[model samples]
Target: MTTSEIWQPPSEFAEQCRELYGLTCPPRWGTPRRPEYPSLGPKAWKVMERLGFPPMPWQRYVLDVALEIDPATGLFAYREVGLSVSRQQGKTQQILGVQVHRAMAWARQNIVYAAQTRGMARQRWEDEFLATLDDSSLAGKYRARKSNGHEAIIWRKTRSKMGITANTEKAGHGPPLDLGVIDEAFAHEDDRLEQAFSPAMLTRPMGQLWWASAGGTDKSAWLNKKRAAGREIVERLWAEGVHPRIAYFEWFAPDDLPRDDPATWRMCLPALGFTVTEATIRAELEKLDPGEFDRAYLNRTRKSTPPQDPNVPVAAWQGLADPVSQAGPELAFAVEVSQDRAWSSIALAAAREDGRVHLELVDRRPGTDWVIPAVVRLRELWDPVAVAVAASGSPSASLIDGLIAAGVTAPEDKERPRRGDLVVMRSGDLVEACGQMADAINQGTAVHRDQAELTAAVSGARTRPSGDAWTLDRRRSLADVGPFYAVTLARWALVSRAEAGRDDYDPLDSVY
Candidate 1:
């Protein structure tokens, strides 16, 4: 299509954040009148097909994102859908087009491109931003402009401007940001990295625009916290209360990607659309040496095996409930801590039929500080029942003492054998204990509160290099407890009072 053939350009439009975001706002900056383009329907699709995209949700989502203009709200409406796809996908074109559209249609508007690193961030403008200008109606928006590498594109217009920068823990200040794009966001740490930079974009009266990458593996901190926060945010905004509108786009291994067929690769990346073909599939399968591909692509996380023997195959554990609804004394619980700073697990195996055990609940939490509170709570409810806690180190020991003093547990003077023991290690015991426990769980003896994390750890755990074994990826699974956490609970519960008070056992923390 000729330049003149393209949609008409407003005599003087601006890229202020409000218009770009499609929000209703008083135009205090940039051009005033709300700019109009054909709804991102037929025409956008025609070009996308020409550009090699199949009719996938991403393409449709991209159009919807482009058509949406709400700087006052719903920057999320754009960000959520745009950033969840692969590297060569069309999002790069989408951001570049949006920036150009804003610059051409709005005046004195600020646009900044950001990435985790400065060099990577600059590449957006060089590859996508500049290329779109070369092919579009935007090439003539400025009489004087410079291709400022990846840093930015500067317009000489006294009325409107566009730029780019990488977001740092420090803000990318100097100009009021109307539009911002974050590339490969899954790589960004979750710990409020965006929060520090986001506020700066809203400095403009029109508000700000944001789009980022899918999250990554930084579990204990970043995305892990955000995953929790995202849940709360969604519940608050969409479920119970009202907050700003937010959006989420996720593409990952499905819950059912079978571990049996390590090559069950097709199940995970369904968003591949027209990109994944028979040839592509065959080639990827061919390239990978079985084990590496399974862990890397399938996301199979390995358990943190004990140093002596990691593969200690754990037998099944089951959770058997009492036939009679209400029975037994107040129950005592024992929890174990893993050596990894990132993981510690607590198990609550309760009394059942004749000498057999059932795990009422289990949690593979992270860190000692995390382990203590739950222990303290369990100790409180089962007061007279001595709490058998793993006495790993000073942190763990202090918590035990703290519990006794704080009335969460029976006094120390009353301590006895079955009540608590470090469950001191025997070289072969770790695996044996895990096997015994796994047997209890598999046969319905032990049950987990949130099976997602526990099952993820169990299934993900696998064989590693020779002599060394699969240790849980604390970075990935919460169930990274070296053998201490899972086994300790079982050992503690087996010796508790069956005839004494065990009725008030609360299964709150262990069950979803």
Candidate 2:
């Protein structure tokens, strides 16, 4: 086929691609609408054929991008490539094809394949890498060495080899690396090992780094950070701008899609029809937790591990539910925002006639932009005793000036004496409020109207240590706990006022 002719997939593979949901990065900053020619796919296909596994269309597309060369420099255009798909989508097969082609066809030297653990690295090398090479047509042409600290394959002619090592800061040293593969990239907590591994590739003219992973914990800070950066680049491309250096591909259902939807399953699992049948996916979904299924099969990063023991027990929180809404005279309000500024909630805690606090979610909305206005509207309606807002460590921190502008401020602020309606919950007070909320739930002193969103937030509330105390851990929770925190702050403000030797204070009457 000529370079000008559009490359067509094999008949079987084309049929499979038609049946699947596939997505790929359009192209690097300034590239053709479609690849003109593939420098790597043909070579990689030969080895896949030898191994009795052919390249899927999606896999072939990845190879074309990974090896796409710059016309002027004759070097790869994208040096860093990220491949994230649901588990069992034949990522290992794709990885194997690339490494083999690099070793045999390109005769590349000093390549390292690292896994999260030594045992995992060894198992992959033994079960897949060595088994493929040993069983292939080129078995007699290569040498496989398995020693205590040394596991590698050597090309007999050029002595070019691929080394297998555990992911460690010390592992990527020694030889100048031509290519690096980080398998299960999501398991890496930080980029320290990657940072150390990268310098070896700096001097190579054709150096490349490929990251492959199934989605991991939401706490995979490093991986999430890179994913965010990759998304920004894609956005820039959509805005008619370009990021020349990086290529990112994700095979996953959109986060908002129904997890059990067949289309969503097919979208994330490119090999659903081939390696895994629809029946198999259904069975897997039935067997796994929703969060686990989201992470493993849907290729989503979620809070996989719920706190060992949450601040509020499910039973305890359920016990506090009063389905019949109650209203009390002395009402206080609190506003809280998610750490990422994605969602915010305002909750009210009213002092009940029975001395217990009755909580209710007043308003919950996306983004911080609506928070100040919502607070102002609630103030006008209820004339709340105080509106507790986080002074630090919250998206609401930015709302302080806005609240003050709307005549809400601290009582001690003489400059804004007419606007002393906002009670700033500092970091120390925030921690105390969280503990207090937990205590009230345990003691059944905090009753709630049993709102679904608030219940979910309460159920997912996990505590994180903050100095001598602990606060709600929003990041590790399954859902946004802003509602939970908002209620807590409101309750604390209401009770704190009553305990401060102000028995005659009727906050509702005073405010109204």
**Which model scores highest in lDDT?**
2
Candidate 2 accuracy as TM-score:
0.61
RMSD of 1: 14.4
Candidate 2 — which residues are off by over 4 angstroms?
A: 1-39, 253-258, 302-458, 461-512
Cα lDDT, all candidates: 0.44, 0.74
What tens digits encode model 2's per-residue C-alpha lDDT throughout 340-426?
Answer: 887889998997767778999888877888888788887887766678888866777888888889877677752332222678888
Ten residues in sequence with the least summed lDDT for candidate 1: 24-33
> Which sections of candidate 1 miss by over 4 Å?
1-55, 62-82, 86-89, 132-151, 154-162, 190-196, 219-224, 235-243, 259-271, 285-512
TM-score of each: 0.47, 0.61
Best candidate (score: TM-score): 2
Clashing pairs counted in every model: 56, 0
Clashes of 1: 56
